[model samples]
Target chain A: EPEVTQTPSHQVTQMGQEVILRCVPISNHLYFYWYRQILGQKVEFLVSFYNNEISEKSEIFDDQFSVERPDGSNFTLKIRSTKLEDSAMYFCASTPDEKLFFGSGTQLSVL
Target chain B: GIQVEQSPPDLILQEGANSTLRCNFSDSVNNLQWFHQNPWGQLINLFYIPSGTKQNGRLSATTVATERYSLLYISSSQTTDSGVYFCAVASDSWGKLQFGAGTQVVVTP
Candidate 1:
């Protein structure tokens, strides 16, 4: 079965540095999303992207966060300046309709 | 935002036993899905039953949208079935999913 794929399974960055997490959603899927889960916490939605625009975002997705579908296959999330609290597992998901496919996730660590 | 509650936060079952997990939502939903998060932390799609019933092997799910609840049944449980089961719901307007805390199941031989 076709699945969502993410790059840089794990990343470590300085507190004031930038990081970009990349994902390649299923080829035919139309909607894409970014979600994060802090250790021992529930998964939280960050933003949803469709038609090259952000459909919705949460409060946590503030000024420092941005998402882009620079190409037909690549979707990415960039954080301008990482904070210690930003350490978590970031998941990328795509849906052809109601069923969403999630990637293995990228573990982001900020120090 | 919708509220989702899952029952029996933790479960323990012996091999060959059966179990049923429940998910309750605070509002009407157009999409409801059940997923199993394996030991490696990968979310495995189990069923996308927005309403009615569907079955696959030893697993089955039923959703009564009007009643605002869904149930997942696991029969002939195995050690491989030990993991976290998550129930997610999307409201009638958008596809954004709000997930329940999940139930952790441990099946022993």
Candidate 2:
């Protein structure tokens, strides 16, 4: 089965520094998404991308957060000036249909 | 946004036991899925059942869309099955999934 791949299994960054999370979605999948889970909390959707544009985003996905598919295969999420609260496990997901497939996740810690 | 409620926030079972986890949603949904988050925090898709029943190995899931609820049953549980089980639903076509708080399960030997 094809799966989404995320790089930097663990990332440590200083508060107010910039960090980019990378994901390589399944080749043929069209819809891509990013979700996050703070330790002990439920997973929350951040943004959804389709056809090179954002379809929908949550309030948590504010000005500081941005997503881009720079190339056809790589989907990246950039956080400018990270805050301590940004520490969490970020998951990248993709789907050809309604059923989504998720990557292992990238654990980000902001100090 | 839809309201999602999961019962018995946590559960513990001895290996070889059976258990059921419940998920209730407030509105109609187009997609419903169950996922298991392992110790490493990887979300593994277990099922995608918006309605009716489906089974895989010792695991099964039934979604009663009319009742707005879903149930996941694990039979002959093993320590490997220990993890946090989550139920998520998408109310719209190709929409974001709203997740439940999840039921944390611990299977002991």
Candidate 3:
């Protein structure tokens, strides 16, 4: 079956440094999303993208974060300056409608 | 924002036993899905039952949208079924999912 794929299975960065997490959603899906899960916490939605633009975002998706569909197949999340609290497992998902396919996730650790 | 609550936060089952996991939501939803997060942290899609019932192998799910609750049933459980089961719902006009804390199930032989 076709699946969403993410890069940098694990990443470690210093606070105040910039980081980019990447994903390639299923080819036919039109909606893409970013979600984060702090250790032992429920997964939280960050943002949703459709039609090459952000459709909606949560309060946690503040100025420090941004998402882009830089190419036909690549969707990326960039954190301008990482913070210790930003450490979490970030998941990328895509959907044609109600059923979503999530990537294996990128574990981000900030020191 | 919608509130999601999952019951039996943790469960332990012996092989060949049966189990049922429940999820309750605070509001009406356009999307409701169940996922299993494996030991390696890979989220695997299990069921997308917004309403009614569906089954796959030893797993089955039923969603009563009007009641705002869903149930996932695992029959003759196996060690491989051990993991975290998450229930997510999308309410309001948009499709952003609100997730429950999840139920950690450990099946032993």
Candidate 4:
């Protein structure tokens, strides 16, 4: 089956450093999203992208975070000046319809 | 924002037993999906039943949109079925999913 793919299954970064997570969504899917799951916590929605523009974003998706399609196949999420609390599993998803397919996820740990 | 609540936060079942997990949402939804997050933290898509019923293998799901609830049924469960099952929904005619805390299922062989 076609699936969304995320890079660097695990990443360790220093606090205050910049980090970028990349994802390749399934081809032909127009809607994309980024979600986060803090350790032992529920998954939280961060942002949704469509038509190369942000459709909606949660408060957790603040100025420190940004998303870009960058090209035809790559979708990337950047966290500027990471904080220790930013340590979590970030998931990328895409959908052609109601069912959103998720990547395995990238585990980000900020020290 | 809609609220999602899942029942029986944790369950332990004998192998081959059948089980049902429930999810309740606060409002009408245009999207409802079931996901299985394994011990390795991989979120695997299970079903997308915003309404009606759908089945795949030993797993099946039913979403009653008018009632604002959905149910996932796992039959002949196996140890491989052990994981956190999440029920996520998106209202507002958008695709941003809001997730419930999830139901942790452990099927012992």
User: Candidate 2 lDDT, tens digit per residue, A18-59?
Assistant: 999999999999999999999999999999999999999999
- TM-score (chain A) of candidate 4? 0.99
Cα displacement (angstroms), candidate 3, residue A89, comes to 0.3
Model 4 stretches with alpha carbons more than 4 Å out = none
Lowest-scoring 10 consecutive residues by lDDT in candidate 4 chain B? B89-98
Give the 10-residue window scoring lowest on summed lDDT in candidate 1 chain A.
Answer: A36-45
Listed per model, the TM-scores of chain A against the true chain A are 0.99, 0.99, 0.99, 0.99
Measured on C-alpha atoms, candidate 1 has an lDDT of 0.93
Over A1-111, each residue of candidate 3 has an lDDT whose tens digit, in order, gives 899999999999999999999999999999999999999999999999999999999999999999999899999999999999999999999988779899999999999
Q: Against the true structure, what is every candidate's RMSD?
A: 1.1, 0.7, 0.9, 0.9
lDDT of 3 at A6: 100
TM-score on alpha carbons, each prediction: 0.97, 0.98, 0.98, 0.97
Candidate 3 docking band: medium
- lDDT of candidate 3 over B25-81, digit per residue (tens): 999998899999999998999998889999999999999999999999999999999
User: If ranked by DockQ, best first, what sequence of candidates would result?
Assistant: 2, 4, 3, 1
Please tell me how candidate 1 rates in CAPRI terms: medium
lDDT of each: 0.93, 0.96, 0.95, 0.94
In model 3, where do residues sit more than 4 Å from their true spots? B92-94
- Identify the superior model by TM-score, candidate 1 or candidate 4: 4
TM-score, candidate number 1: 0.97
Kindly list the interface RMSD, in angstroms, of each predicted candidate in the order they appear: 1.5, 0.7, 1.6, 1.2
Quote the positional error of residue B72 for candidate 4 in Å.
0.6
